[model samples]
Target: MTEAKRIPKRSEMDPKYMWDLTPIFESDDEWEKAFQEVKAYITQCQALQGTLGDSAESLLKGLRLQDQVNMKLLKVYVYAHLKKDEDSTNAKYVAYNDRASSLANDIQNALSFVVPEILSIEEDTITQFLQENEDLTLYRHALDEINRQREHVLSASEESIIARAGEVTSAPSNIFSMINNADMKFPRIKDENGEEQELTHGRYVHFMENNSRRVRQDAFEAMYDTYKKQKNTLAATLNASVKKNIFYSRVRRYPSALEASVQKDNVPSKVYEQLIQAIHEYLPVFHRYVALRKKVLELDEHHMYDIYVPLVQEVNMKYSFEEAKDLVLSSLTPLGEEYRDIVNKGYESGWIDVYENEGKRSGAYSSGTYGTPPYILLNYQDNLDNVYTLTHEMGHSLHSYYSRREQPFVYSNYTIFVAEVASTLNEALLTDHLLKTTEDKKRKMYILNHYLDSFRGTVFRQAMFAEFEKIIHEKVERGEALTPDSLSELYYDLNVKYFGPDMKVDEDIALEWARIPHFYYNFYVYKYATGFSAATALSKQILEQGQPAVDRYLQFLKGGSSKYPIDLLKQAGVDMTSPDPVRQALQVFEQTLDEFEALVLDK
Candidate 1:
């Protein structure tokens, strides 16, 4: 095996390989100019605050100005954050992002008065305002969305206080990351050849997938033990973060913290409940899969660490970054020529930061503002994983491109409820393409297992996480102690329920929740589960129905925040409020498991 190369500094890379920040702002000096101009707009918004109640004309002027401010603010914030992500250690960009964040808060606080004032107007009068000004129809949906939040909308002062406190409330998440990633260290674990390898977070995934069971066990133990040691501290940070959610929920008159979180996306609590209930219905399939894993791995005693080890360990499938790009393009052809054209642009243009550098942000994400093309951040390694990552982020970029092109700024951004659908849909399409194209038996089995595992991870595991968050938050709400032991105990039981009786529920595995950054994300994991289900259903539609389904899916990509997420998905042909999509998704998982079992029998 060849030695891995160290990541290069940002300055050392070819400019063409990097995302073109010039499209956002030509220079730092220009960025500075826009930053000051946003300040003036913020002040302009403040001037129009009380005047919204004066007349329809006054309200229209206020809203139009507010939209301008929102657009400018998005551009400025995204530009700085993109530069900051390129090199997190760069003090200049760090300061740039920090200042951008503060400016965002300023704008939020300044504009906080407008909504409450608008809501203060009589509904009939507001309707008359809209009737009198035909031009104001553009903001009709926008206003209706805000007016729907009438009960949740606090007083101007109260909202201003909350807006300003946003930075303060988010500190626990920042502190948790600092401690979890930067401060803690895991013990070295002996590799298959008996050489000590230092266990880092990145290496943990590789180690978990190692062929040697001993190596996987050692790495798991070391990683969890490190987390176990800090459980109390981690719990405290997580608890405070939960409290922040509860605090906002209480003040905003929401019935629960989960409600407060999901309601922002206009998603019904029933969607969240349906996900958990639907996954519970599919637990038997998971049990069967686990039983089969125990049999196929041929272990005398199955353990938690054995789960990630490949059932077929001999296949060494790898692809170069260039190859990954080609595969992604071919994989997405079901979406038709126009959609594929946008993807080709993504490939030809510098829409992706395709490789890791010394201080680049970890993992991958698709990000952009209304005025610019979507940009992707990726720590790309040349393999099947990177290919999937490429397609996933490209899904997001294409979604943004269509939305921005089709809608105004106010409706150009989609919420998290629908955001994951595009990315996961891309993965599903890519997986089908790979399966159809590959003829090698070993590669087929590997891809088959990979597809099953992806569903398991995205749908089932995230549902378990959603359940855990619900349990912990309810415990906190009931005034129960959220000690390390209590949190671990609940988490451990969920693991047992999720993975089933075939695999040992290792005691150390209880501390697994301690290190998950998503718990602090407040009911966010459930979206991954729901999104996968929706995507599975939609991908099947696009593949089978061809042109008609492709048209609906493209319309969905362009819908953005114009409607509630549930409504948007319904228009896209997945009714997430019902359990049908989840049912279909789990059925697909079972089918994949059956296929895997047949392959193993042949072997």
Candidate 2:
């Protein structure tokens, strides 16, 4: 077969071909006009605070105006951000993003008093006000959730201090993104054809999928080498982020940073610890998979670089963009006609800005606002992986679409805790669909490899990162400095633990944490593992149990922020607080490994 066509240039595509944002704002001029209005309204919010507790009518009026201001501000912010992310290198777009972000901060600073002042009123009085005002019905859930956290609500002075310190607090994550995306450069690696290719985040996956072992090894080393050289810089950035968490937790009067961070989503620290414990108990399954990899590759030792190579070779399934869309539609039929219809609307409408373009965001995401259609940004190539990613991101878009349609603006946005479930469920269905339909042994093995890799990365690898994040946070909580040596040693030790006794834990791998952007999110990496586990359990329900299971899952999609994340997930038939879902998910992983071993080893 002829070599796959080279990736096309962005300039070759028409600008009009991109996702139409006219529905969001008639034009950039209109967006700017609204931006100015929002800037003026921030001052209006500053004046509404003292009036809030005066009377039910006055409080209702003030709250309604604040809601309007917030919705418009979010729209303006999303428009500027979506535009900038589509072309990060553009100077004008960069300015737009910075201005929008600054305006958001300004709005937050201005509205800081609203919550504190609201909490200061007698709880019974506010409850009476909610009962009295018809217009405030939309905000009842939002108000109740806030009131639930009343004890944690700080004094007005403390709230103002924290609001003003937001930018300084986010400095580490900001610096890390700037350096990693814009400044860091990786070494070149020779491709299968012996042509040197520059390593990029976009190309790293392609290199890792190379049929040539030498190429994969070289690309891995080349990518990590750059990270190794900048290890000190990365270490400092992560250290500051951890310290920020610790400081904020202490100032907020929480016993620990993990508690402070996790409690925001109503997640107990036990949930976090349960995930680690469940995955640790299944370490033997991971080691078995590693051993199978070494056996398949006919190697005495399995290095980290050897992890991604396919167990079955000579299996190529190329998909066009249109074909991928059809597959996504088929895979999602489990979600019911209404759910699938909305997805179809998204496809027919300009919900997706499909295909790669110069200066486009490196990865994929589903982003939109309460008043708009959920929009997706993807750098799609016509491959199996791209098909899965399309399904994945569209899962997010549809979740947002359903939630916004079913709930009010205040409850429209769901927390990240349950965000990945729909996306990965789509993926699981697609995998099962492919395996059941395809008869070719090599293709079957290829599909199985993809499934196993999902578990390996999303399940095992993220758990490892979660463990590292916990260790570093504890260090900071104990008043220990997270220097480069200390961070690297801690990360490297975890790598050794997860990879087991067989694989070689290269020294260069320790610097891996420095390169990961998730570390900047402060105790956020664990969600990937939890999300996949939940998705695995949910997918089983949908396939084996049919409409009843799907109805529960769809209820979860529509729940949004109306309920606590864990409570909402429980409504969907997966109890995240317990370790059963995670353990069951790992069992599925081992079963897949057994199937993969039987197929490849006997052949």
Candidate 3:
């Protein structure tokens, strides 16, 4: 009997691989000290609430104070949440996260008067103040953003009441996070060696990509079965989350949750709608790719689990963490030496948590705030997918790196609409590098297959999610309750529509929504699709046009929230307002598919 492989406990991880948090806080004791001090600042923020409309100096003082408190608050919250994500089972850090969350709500409530107070001031008065005070000019854009939402801004008391409920409103996402990361259990499945192995969120992808059909099917059933058991509870959590979106949308006077969400980034609802409409037009392109996967794999009937395995599986393209870093650095050469050096610095510095451990969060992200290194968290597996993930996350961290260096703290964070652009652009560059460098037909096919898979996952799949979010929100707005069966039915139907009739859409795949954390993100998944489209266009420019294109892209990264996301992308040379980018990306996918099929038929 083979002993099942166990996840390493946090205490057992190598010290060099773990991120160094001392840059943010010297120790837990220091974090504690900062926590108390920020609590004091939160109270101080409340003192300036009534003074914003008094005079220009008073308004500037209140605004500056708000930035000071928020910067401090973000630093504290980032540290706590990162610590919590390291190992959610650790009670101490969990408490730290909870406390930080509560303090965040307190800070929001304390400063809630700022927006309404600003709105209360006559627009001509604000114009005069900006003209009179050079310091106030710094916040002209920020004030303009506030003024743009004048109809949405409630009275100060009402705004404060809503802000105080932040924690309560956030409860659904928090509960789902705990359940998905900490409490849920997956059944053991036999690996390729026929030895029993425990399934995890991090390991599930590797399992699906396993060469053995039995392994893939077993892991698929085990993964979905686990979620199936808690379907009702998961449905309730999702229902609560959707309701929360609706509640806030109505309170803020938005027409719907989708508008409320896109409004933050100043994106038109048509952008979201256009993505779905474009993908629908390109469904045949995706269906053709699905048919190719079926024919190449030589499967009599293809299941959802069958899609992830490479078409050229005979070539073992597995890579180590060091090798992945080397590949990523080499691939990003088009961006120049300065960009490459920053990636190398991130590697040498304590900017990334490089591997998975027991109780660690699944998936990957780049996270940080002003006055901190943009840190990346990855539950790395030694595969080509993880290599793409490395470059993707590095893209995000580097975006943060440039933004923080160039913009003021008030404009530091980019909108979520443009957030995925930097990340997916790296994935495109990596694919281009591998295809250009690899001489062997098999290796090239594998890279091509992976690129297409990236498209399938990022564009087709996420657009499906975007549609799901839209449908569910609309349904709930019409007073329809989202039951477990209804959610599963709707999800299954979407799968059928997207994947086409060539593949067998398994019943278990219906429960996949139960496992996705992005649905909790409130219309967030569509950006992955839109961003990938924008990135595909930009990657072409960078590759074909050279240094000039790179200059424009780097500038876009540095712009942050100083300009709207659409405007920033316009500066970067991609006009996302049109459907051309999506259609252009699909053309690339089809051209690649044509080449892959030629290789197959010639063989």
Give the candidate number with the greatest lDDT.
3
| Candidate 2 residue-wise lDDT, 498-581, digit = tens | 978878887878878887888888788788889999999999989999999988998999999999999998899989988999
TM-score of 2: 0.95
Residue range 1-603, candidate 3, lDDT tens digits: 999988898999997888988889999998999999999987788888778888889999999999999999998999999999999999999999999999999999999999999999999999888877899988999999998899998999999999989999899899999999999988899999989989999999999999999999999999988998899999999999999999999999999999999999999989999999999998998888889889988999999999898888789799999999999999999999999999999999899998889889999999999999999999999999999999999999999999999999999999899999999999999999999998998998889889889989999999999999899999999999999999999999999999998889999999988888999899999999999999999999999999999999999999989999999999999999998998899889889889888887877
Candidate 2 local accuracy as lDDT?
0.83
Could you tell me the C-alpha RMSD of candidate 2 in Å? 2.5
Backbone clash count for every predicted candidate, in the order shown: 0, 0, 0
Pairs in clash, predicted candidate 3 = none
**Models sorted by lDDT, best on top:** 3, 1, 2
Give the winner by TM-score: 1 or 2: 2
TM-score of 3: 0.99
Looking at model 3, report the run of 10 residues with the lowest lDDT sum.
42-51
RMSD of 3: 0.7
Question: Model 1, residue 291: what's the lDDT?
Answer: 91
TM-score winner among the candidates?
A: 3
Compared with the true structure, what per-residue lDDT tens digits does model 1 show for residues 1-603? 433334478889877678988888999999999999998876787788779978889988988888889899888999998887787768798789879988998999899898888888998988999999998888888889988889999988888899899878877887775576446766777788877766765567668888988899899998888887788889889889988988999999998899899999888899889889989999999999989989988877789888877787788767887888888899988998888898889877788887666566666789998989899998776556668889989998999999999998788888889888999999999999989998999899999988888887889999999999998888888888788888889999999999988988899989988878889888999999899999999999999999999999999999988888899899989898888998899999999999988998998
Over all chains combined, what TM-score does candidate 1 have? 0.94
Off by over 4 Å in 1: 1-17, 180-200
Whole-model lDDT per candidate: 0.86, 0.83, 0.93
